[model samples]
Target chain A: MTIEQIRKTFDSFLEEHLAFGQPEGLYEPLHYLMKQGGKRLRPLLLLLATGLYDDRFERGLHAALAVELFHNFTLAHDDIMDEAATRRGKPTIYKKYGLPSGILTGDLALIYAYEQLVMGLPASLAIRLMAIFNGFAVDVCRGQQLDMEFEMREHIRMEEYLQMIAWKTAVLPAGALQIGALIGGASEEEAAILHRFGLQLGLAFQLQDDWLDTFGDEQKTGKRKGGDILQQKKTALVVYVLEHGSPEQARHLLEALKSDELQDAEKIAAVQGFLEVSGAKAAIDELQRKYTREALAQLASLNLPEARLQPLKMLAEELMGRKG
Target chain B: MTIEQIRKTFDSFLEEHLAFGQPEGLYEPLHYLMKQGGKRLRPLLLLLATGLYDDRFERGLHAALAVELFHNFTLAHDDIMDEAATRRGKPTIYKKYGLPSGILTGDLALIYAYEQLVMGLPASLAIRLMAIFNGFAVDVCRGQQLDMEFEMREHIRMEEYLQMIAWKTAVLPAGALQIGALIGGASEEEAAILHRFGLQLGLAFQLQDDWLDTFGDEQKTGKRKGGDILQQKKTALVVYVLEHGSPEQARHLLEALKSDELQDAEKIAAVQGFLEVSGAKAAIDELQRKYTREALAQLASLNLPEARLQPLKMLAEELMGRKG
Candidate 1:
């Protein structure tokens, strides 16, 4: 089946399983946030990686739900921690219900994610899955912690910034692919390669996102250009300037970011000019391309038929492509 | 070894395992809360239960840490949800670190819980333990949800209140005993009996706590008399008055509870009279005794040697006996 069909099948299963709890307030926010929709990228990665080794899509459904619910759980709590009002263009659990609901919903989702993981599996597989999933969870938590701490500080090293992004955004896809590959009978070595493939894909995807938020066409991206600049988010572009720009250029960009009086449009324009002059924009664009290329190379390192590799290749390109 | 030895070993193992993660803010709260210790009762029950079958306190240390961490995770988040300022006579994570840390700390502790659960076990036991822990977690979440919802409404059925109390306060100890018994090679039937034993013990423990807060001697209990009454908590006694009292009595009880004009001492005295006249105090006390009796009966049904069962028997009586 295609990824679309897998998504459809997964959604039906998820809807049936998710609403089984009592206390209406506890589970409703889960359904409400999930219904708002997302790329369903993590689950798809798991399913596709499973397909690459063997057809266990039926059993893989449990794993697919595990990653999906885990992702949503992070989003629910991250929204609360970030004080985010909306996600996927919908009001966050915090905004929609209250702080208590936000905390509880995230918790229930995380526990349920574990339930789905070991639902019908044999003992050995369940043990392996639990270990991998738990590590992935800890990495994400550490990433979020670093990100929150970074918000209060004036400077962050490029190495530290990359680790934060990898933990926060990249590990889910990487772990999903690795988990699915192992479940489908891949050797540990093969699973490691698949995880690397996903890691690069995830990094490229996030870097491209940072680039598009300021540089892409609003019509094509369907988002206002400079959204990141308006929020003063320390995206890859901002981090690049901090690492590589001249002192005057870095100071100018930082001042513009901290300035409340500057109009949003003018700030965006000025930051864009700084990005261009500092060579930061081109460097990050090159970095995104490099990761995309490395991801494909990792995919090629596997001895699978070209047809089996086609879906992952197309997805990496779609996510990292300049067209957004 | 005695329960004291088990707790000390468990503490050392827990400290070594818990502080491994980084980004100081994320892990420090866990350390802080764990240090401000309680009775360590759940882990004690687990270790003693393990002793009842085979002495595996070494391996049971992991299970002990899992339950202890799970309990603290609940406390950390529940404090935020309840807007509580202190736990175990110390400022709570919410009071000390703020809301985001409270949420994130709980999230990390819970994830760490799953990590310790599967750390070094054989596949089958780990699988069984995971399922049990996950179910226990969901029940507590549902219980907390109900408790929070109850605060917003005026009336709740006795049955509903019991379910909430059982879910919130009973499952941790129950699950701990069940897990440890199974690990020590108890049969499914044996584990079930142990679980039921812990369940009743937990209920009696919590009910006795409520009774003590309102009805026991402050000098002996070491808590202010009528503390729960002061908080206007809808505990079992209050639920009984609402369930069985005359309309005028129930109305007066509730009005006195809600009235700000009543002196604290006068309000406590008035509420005590309603409880006596309505038989809520006696009924709840009887209910607590029933649970305690049934719990001992469950322990007796287990065919373990008398010497093997002595520790748990003594502990139960220590917790449930009215001597204090």
Candidate 2:
């Protein structure tokens, strides 16, 4: 099935399956967050990976839904941890409801995600999927923890930042693909290759997000430009500037990030200028391109027919090509 | 093995296995909360249940640890939701570490709990346990949600109160015992009986806790007298008073519970007098006894020899006898 068809199926599953229980306070926020749509990229990856190995990708529907629910669970909790007020251009659950409801709802989502996971798979396959899912779940938490820690520290290495994002952002995608491959009856070696492809693709996707947060058109991205700069987030561009820029450039960039005197617009402009002048913007672009190429290389080496892999190739292009 | 021996083994496993990973901000609260230590009742129940059917209770060590960790995870998050400053007479994780840390640590503990669960069990058994664990996990969240909802509303029915406590406080114990029985090679029917046994015992334990909260010596309980009264918690005693008291008596009790003009001691004495005069206190005591009898009846019907059931009997007595 094509990625669009898979997404349509997944959306219907979500609509039919995501019902609220009693106590509106606990379950309402969950319904609200799930309705505030995302790209559904992780579930699509799972479906595409399954389709690559087996025609009966439909058998992996629960796993696909599980991945999407788990991803949203992380997002809901991470919003609280990050003190984020908005998600997908809508009020976050934490902001819309309160902290207790936010935390409880995320928890319910996680439990429901697990429930979805073990639904239809055989016992052995369910156990394997659980092991993989739990590993990635822990990785996501660790990544989030590191991200929070990094905010309080004055210095962080580029390598450390990469590791943090890989955990925070990449592992879910990689796990989704690997789980789908397993469900599709792929050998461990083949799943490993798909995992690698997913990891690189995820990295590129995140870098693109980081880039778009500062550089893309606001209309396309559905967000204000330079949001990362305004928040003083240490994205790839910021980390590159910190590590590779001249001392004066680094000092100016740091001051721009820390200055409460500057308005949001001024801060964004200053940080953007620093990134451009210090060549960090170009460097981040290069890194994004390199990872994208690496991901495609892994896909090419899979030896699957191009026609069968067309959906995944199209997805890769769309992810990398996003102005948003 | 005896309950004491199982507890000792479990403690050693905790010391050896509960190590935290990087980013102390996220992990330190977990370490602190685990170290604060509760009765270790849930894990003990698991071990005893395992011992009931199999001598090699050691094989269930990881599951025992998983239960304890998951319990602590619930405690950490619950304390935050309750806005509770202290647990076991020590500052709560939220009070000590801050909100984000409390939430994140709880998430980490839950993830680690899953990690612990999937370790060393056969695939089939692990899958079964996962299904059970996930069911109770959702139940706990649902229970907590109902509890928070209860706090806001003035009137709560006795049946609703019973259901709330069963979800909030009883299921973990039930799940623990049931899981242990499964690990011990019990049939599904046998596990179901143990589950019912646990449910009734858990209700007795919670009612005892409510009884102790107001009436037990402060020194023994390590908390202020009339804590539930002060908080206006809808305990079994309060529920009985509301359900059975004369209209005038119920009015007085409700006013005493809500009056800000009354001193703490006065409120406690007034509410206690109402409970005594209306026979609500006696009713709650009778209910506790009835549940305890039901629990023991289930145990007796299990057909296990008296010698094999001694530990569980002792445990039930100790739980019902706790002043603290």
Q: Compute the interface RMSD for each candidate structure.
A: 1.0, 1.5
Q: What is the lDDT of residue A111 in candidate 2?
A: 79
Q: What is candidate 1's TM-score against the reference?
A: 0.98
Tens digit per residue, CA lDDT, model 1, A1-82: 7767878988888788775668787878878866778888898889888888887666688888989889989998999888
Query: Which TM-score value belongs to model 2?
Result: 0.97
Residue-level lDDT of model 2, residues A1-324, one tens digit each, is 667788999899888889577666677888897889888989999988988999998878898888988988888888988888987778899899888888988888887888888788888898888888988998898898899888887677888988998999999999999999999999888888899999999898888889888888888877779878877788888888878877777778888988999888888888888788889888888899999999999999997898988999999998898764
- Chain A TM per prediction: 0.97, 0.95
Off by over 4 Å in 1: A322-324
| 10 residues in a row with least lDDT, candidate 1 chain A | A315-324
The true-versus-predicted C-alpha distance at residue B35 of model 1, in Å, is 1.5
DockQ each: 0.85, 0.72
CA displacement after TM-score superposition, residue B128 of candidate 1 (Å) = 1.1
Residue pairs whose backbone atoms clash in candidate 2:
none
